[model samples]
Target: MEPENTTQNKPRGRVVMLVDNGVKGDSRVQKAARSAADAGWDVVLFGVSPDGEKHSWKVGSAEVRLIPKPGPLNPRRHDMRRPLFRRPLAYRSPQVARYRVQAVKAWRSDLSFRQAAVKAARAGHPGRSAGGSKARLLVPRVSSKVYSKWVALRARETTDLQQRRSMLDARLDRATTALWQGLMKQRSWRRLTPNLWDFELAFAKHIDKLKPDLIHAHDFKMLGVGARAAVRARAAGRPVKLVWDAHEYVPGLPPRHGRWLPGHVAWEKEHAVFADAVITVSPALAELLKKGHGLSQLPTVVLNAPVLSPGPDEVAGAGPVPDLRELCGVGPNTPLLAYVGGINPVRGVETIVEGLTQLPDVHVAMVSVPPGKPYAATATIRKLVDKLGVGDRVHFLPFVPHWQVAEFVAPADAAVSPLHHLANHELALSNKFFEYSQARLPQIVSDIRTMSEMVRSTGQGEVFRAQDTDDYVRAVKAVLADPERYRAAYDKPGLLEKWTWEAQAEILDGIYSRLLPDRPRIAAQPSGSRADARA
Candidate 1:
């Protein structure tokens, strides 16, 4: 650990990070942890714990704070929703006008409910004396007290639900103090998207408490928490350096899947402008931030790949990869094609399935994320595949831990990323891109700018023209036909090589050593949404 600079003149910065639900139970989170610890920075990771732990706890060298997990893993107990009491949306929207409307409505509703209930009682007891009304009264004192308490409790509970609903109605305002508290409480955002954000908050809170020199937030979902945490830290006069890693294009999130209603572009646009340094996983996204977003001030682009070597195992949440033959009844020799990660429309797993149906001899295995996740288009695709008559050939392993993903892919004849072109996918440098490369395996991927660039650079994969089923079909068939070519591709050096959390950690170590040296260091604004132009 870097020695604290107790010298009066020496400045020692203390950084506090908020990791959100993602940094827990994820290899990337572990990688972030390694980066912080290796850099000799004190880090507290606020996120939920796996297997139902109570209280905030430390994982490895970093603290892991627990946030309530969302939803029933069993599914039957609750649909993809929070209990009414936990709703953030029900409270009010973030927009002043809409939020005020909701707030006023709530105030009125609670007031009216109490007034009406009391008025009815008073009218019913019109003949009661004033002294009796005050003392013995229209009702028993115990009963009145209990009834008032129940009414107040009911109103408060109802308000919580309304707040959650309002939060959703207005679009999830992640870049604020309000969003994360829900995940920590399981009262607001946690109930909204349990799997998505619960752990992210716990990690962020712990990060905030530890006061590290540097903070790394991966992906857009966690960005809000990281930003909010930084904002809070700075407000408290803590100095922290924040590294904002963009795994995918934020504005491009919709339309890759069936679309989940709509969200405000301003939210992400504002966030993009607000980040300290916009680190992108893909060059394409870097270009987007530079060109489209007018973020002249944001220091952007420190590209990354998923770590190839063993990462933090505690967060990996993986056991040995499930045996496919035993689980699926498929012979060990059966040719398998695999697609991992959120099975959303942008991923184009449906295209992979259709393309595979053309090949006929291959099977498709989806190892990450279940079809049932509300956000996944996987279920919809499954029904479509059944209609297309290839249902049995394609299967889902659901969300395997990051550690076991390679296990699922190892048994496959090929891996693929058949993504639909979008701002998000166009700028995406997906984890699976490097995951396949680290395994030294051949892959078929979308011809999106970022993905194609990787395939061309690494020579480890074939690029199917974007969203073209025939292109996917041909690519897979060619790999199946030419084992030598596949081997040739796999033998080539990958961008995935020389880029592990270790290397990133060394860079981070240097960053912290220079930035902090003794005590913790901090950025002017620790993290999130730094626009080049003043906001």
Candidate 2:
């Protein structure tokens, strides 16, 4: 660790922020890093590198470091105690015992042999020589009756044994599952997810070397990373404060197969209590986090609003924002609807494409994530578009800078947010909701609790049944018919201004100030001092 400057002018404490993404398009983390750096703290943001090599760049005053995230990538490999095939009883499927198989086969073989012997005896019988045909027939019939009774008795015994084995397997399975779940309650049980451990292995040493005064963990995965790092730093006699930024309500996220959902929920529950402070994107989320973590104070709310403009605190490098109508090859007279953010089924983007079939001359501009790369959801949406024969009307564009989203979509006739009625969607406002309002584009939002209520209350636009194509078409036409009336919602006092990143940054800065009052301010340093600075 760098020795503290002992001079009369002490350097401000350093802050390290951890995120699980590549950090190229994560507006919330970028905004937080820039805001903290502007407030005079030496901030370094760490993210997972897409490539194997480590890379670094400057996001305004904050230094962004992308650490290589090497992995086996499978959760099952993390458990040192068991091999892949030898999973715990609860995770393994029941197999028929070898003894039972052998026993059943032996009984069937004996019965076949007895039946053949009886037929041979009937064929060789004294047939009409002594007591004639009656004797031969009687002998075969008596043997057949005896053999049938024996087969019935053995079958009943085999059936009873099989039933007992099934009952035992069931009881054992239940017991093992209960035991595994009980073990998961302990913090050490996190080893089940090796990828998470890989994250810690990749970033912990770098974080420790920096000896940061504060660790701001973004989302659930980093919360554990930051919390554990803080514990290590404290043990080494360095005082490190921890801040957990809950990006979403983990329990409310869509269900995932295997251990993903429960593992993350457990991980969050374990580490959230260690945070000196917590911040989330919405008031509803904040309240849930407060109660869920049993924190004494409610988490500070920082909505993921768009940048009003490039201020001293905001980061640059998003490149030029494109104009929506020009990008769509549409004129002002043509009706255009815009959708931004990730492409997913739950996002309800299919509703928009399906709606286009009914509303001719209406074009859609969909801006998806990771810029140019094709993702699974993107492919699905494309297939739907092709199937519906609306390929010509829908224009798929790469995402613009987060701050520039509103400007990018400003020329569209109206913005549509057709998010499905998921729990997280219902409980919070989406980034597009605020972005559309900032552009003064009339909104066509789904009837999710938070967004629908906001749109209805503000009179910004109309709400439709989530994922209902017919209703979505109705809302889109309503807006297209009289966009002026819906656009008037922006005229309401402080509506747009209240939802900008600048407003949210103030609350963020205040939280920082309150948490680290004693920490001194670090003087601004040059960017090229780092060894890994991008060429």
Candidate 3:
């Protein structure tokens, strides 16, 4: 239930939400902004522009602005490129020095071999010995013995030099790797990947101008941005509240680069303290984040559940929700499985495609890749399907609007969440899990802890070993054999109601209300102040 807002009649406050994505498919941020707006707060959601250009739009009463954050300061590509904020060339370019040393050693090795050959040749020559014919002949025999020894010694020395050269190369490579890892372990690792700086530079000025009473930073990248902006507001005597919404555990995420894990962990550690309140996706994640950050208060768990609609057969939105079965060109009786979410290796999309080969009659609607966009995983999935010779059985489709996902995927016989067992995957019930439940589709989920336990406890569907093709086939066969039995799980009263964005939004509203009670607020920028002058 939504906490009673004692400040309901008071003037609504302005909120500036900062996220790190393009905001096109980010449902969590979209839902949060929309919920805040619906609760009578003026909301502006700022996100990084996908095409390095500005974009503006509206999500319900909330305003969305995509700021173009273009520069060499991307964490994914930071270490690969020349450092954006460079150190001294000698300090930065160790590869250059390593290569130079290897080249000189190679040159010296070659020169020694050549000089030894010349000396051996000279020693063997008869004319170089000062003596009579007998002595000359004897000298030739002795010189030949000496020259042979020299040749043997030189060959061994050359082999040793080459081996030493290889060892030196390997040593240097290890040294380089160690140096990088060491630097990332330090307190100032953020300087190496200055992408956060780029984000701050892009959004901070806009944040100041908005004069927001609250700053909602989505994920780790924006945590610092929101904190700095909140400090700026407070320093100017505006008293803005900061909320950090940690989407996932930083250490649990797949590291994009060598410095990605440690750098982000340190970054979040520094800025998370500034947040007046924290919001997270699941109870498990909330507990982990609380312990990880050692926060004064545990984070509020706001699930990424779909917004509940009035009718099951129809969506509340205006757009046409595509039929998953029709798109696959399969009839209602056909065994159809729907997989909704982004296409990635860890998502275990390959397990679903591979499993299709065993269930020949089964057709799958892969809503993996986004519409009209090039995703690398699309090709990977296609290659796997082609290799397995299941092209005709699979259908590739685009994503529907966030609110329509449950309705969009409802036509399929069952929904599959074959997510691989990663730390985050094991802990949380994915949005698709709730969406499938909302659609009343029997779930064929992976054996990852949370979703699997839910599936077993609720008797919603079958749980298979994650990434195990044979186990997935068995689970699919079980569900297709008696999907209605699994579907009956939805018949339980109020189960669907508990897993919804509306229910999650109530928790969000309460968090906002508790953080910023009934009070008068100052402008984010005061008149004749430096912030106003900059604006």
Candidate 4:
């Protein structure tokens, strides 16, 4: 193939991706943004502001604006429903519980409204009882004494019904506000600030200012927001395709810590009906869409891949960041096991911690590169490290910037992910697994589907019984002794191929392509097994 005289940074379509701003330092988002920018999409991001700054939006090569989630009116919102007010009762906080009570009260209003309508019909009025002539005509003629008695009885009942209905109406109004709030939750109040409304104008307004051909919306968070923008553009008679990348079983899940709403499920189906194209990430998720819902018909499943060339220097420059022994205060020959990402129970961080106690010279440096909330639990993990007498070994790097991650984990003897025995964990495809390959660092992973199959297939790492701390410890010792012996397994020719964001964005590129078939088609279907794509 002849090399074309082209600049790598040629612009594509104007794209506006939505993510939490604090995740600016997260490698995944960074890679996604880089891929979109390199492909020539005028990309701008809208995330919660980092500082106390409010309502910020930027435009440029790849603009990143930090908008306050809890806006000027309500800067520190405790309810998640109101993007500006992100408090959720799911924390079971007194305030959240009060909101729950209010929710029940609001639903009761709907019931009351129905009752009011029935009573009104029975009284010979659809909305209210107007005794002008219709009321008198509806009632039968009788003696003055009998008629007076009937009128008195009816008036009392009418007054009681009206009072009850009025109360319910007020309650319903309040409940609607609370329920809507519970639907939009982020880890913190600030994170929810920029997402002020369910349909954010700032997002569409920013995108419109950029004016891209196709709008690719990831997750249901931006489904309606992006679709509405497409509708507005369409009304203006602009031919814009609204692409939805469905990452979850949206209708299958409910609002965070919210009671199931039959209406929410209906709403997702409605949104898909309106979208130009819907893209899904997983086959299972796609299958669920098809089987559980009639969404299999939509052209979906753009495999996560990279379209751009790998930065040779990133891998070439990939070397250990710190002296593992010195950083963790262990002896020169102590075993240093690394685990990246935030520490969470589901990811099996606790199991890793518990297993580490049994190993001699095993210092688990959990490079908490990325942090997410439910702070109380994260705090608890740090305490466990201290209480377990491994305080010196386990350290939480609450915030790890993207570039420096290479430096932190480069020197690790081996990396491990001891996830619990959950179906989700079995199919896990975390960045750590890929990063280990990139750095040539061997791994000791959980014996679940994706990680287990990966370890067994590639021999790049080892796997152990997921919850069995004893097995995890045994595997760690085996890998630390001779990681290179098993290196032949995972370091395949195309192993590093898909982990890059440039590759991953191709999946997005595929979804967007169907949206605008008339546009140029530069994407190609990659040759791989289903396991490879899933991994």
Return the TM-score for candidate 1, rounded to 2 decimals: 0.60
Better of 1 and 2 by TM-score: 2
The digit string of per-residue lDDT tens for model 4 on 1-535 reads 1111222343345566666445445445445555555445556655556674644322223456555444443322333232122221123233444454455555445445655665777777766432223344333323333544544444444444334433223454346535544564321221322333433544556556555567666666566667667787888878877767665565445243222223344345445656767666554566666665465474465443322333333334444345554666766576778887766666788888887688756777777744455445578787877888877777555434344444457677788877776644554455666666665678888887766786787788788887788888888878877877866655577776765554667766666556666656543322221111111
Query: Looking at candidate 1, what is the lDDT of residue 247?
Result: 62
In model 4, the Cα lDDT at residue 407 comes to: 46
- From the highest TM-score down, the ranking of the candidates is 2, 3, 4, 1
The runs of at least 3 residues in candidate 3 whose Cα sits more than 4 Å from the true structure, single-residue gaps closed, are 1-10, 72-186, 309-319, 519-535
Each prediction's total of clashing residue pairs, residues at least 3 apart in sequence or on different chains, is 58, 1, 0, 24
Best candidate according to lDDT: 3
Candidate 3 global TM-score: 0.74
lDDT of 3 at 399: 75
Which candidate model has the greater TM-score, 1 or 4? 4
lDDT of 1 by residue, 1-535 (tens): 2222311232433334444454544666666664564344455554544455644544444445545555333221222344443443332222333444455556545544554555556778442232233333324445545655554554565465445444344343333324444334323333334343333444554555455555666666566566666677778887655666666665566532211212223334434544666666555677776775676644344434454444343334535557654555578777777677776666677787677667777877767555344445756887888888987887766665554455556666677888877766677666676666555567888888777886777666688887788877888887777645664765545434454444555555454555455655443221222111101
How far in Å is the alpha carbon of 79 misplaced in model 3?
8.1
Per-residue lDDT tens digits of candidate 2, residues 174-288?
4543465587673533643446778888889988988888899999999989999999999999878998898889889864434455567777888887899998888788888
Off by over 4 Å in 1: 1-15, 48-55, 67-212, 215-238, 255-276, 291-304, 307-318, 323-333, 368-376, 493-496, 517-535
Misplaced by over 4 Å in model 2 are 1-11, 72-177, 183-188, 311-320, 520-535
Query: Largest TM-score belongs to which candidate?
Result: 2
List TM-score per model, in order: 0.60, 0.75, 0.74, 0.62
Q: Across residues 289-344, which tens digit of lDDT does each residue of candidate 3 receive?
A: 99998998889888889875422212323456666777888898888889988888
Distance from true position, residue 513, model 1, in Å?
3.9
Rank by lDDT, highest first.
3, 2, 4, 1
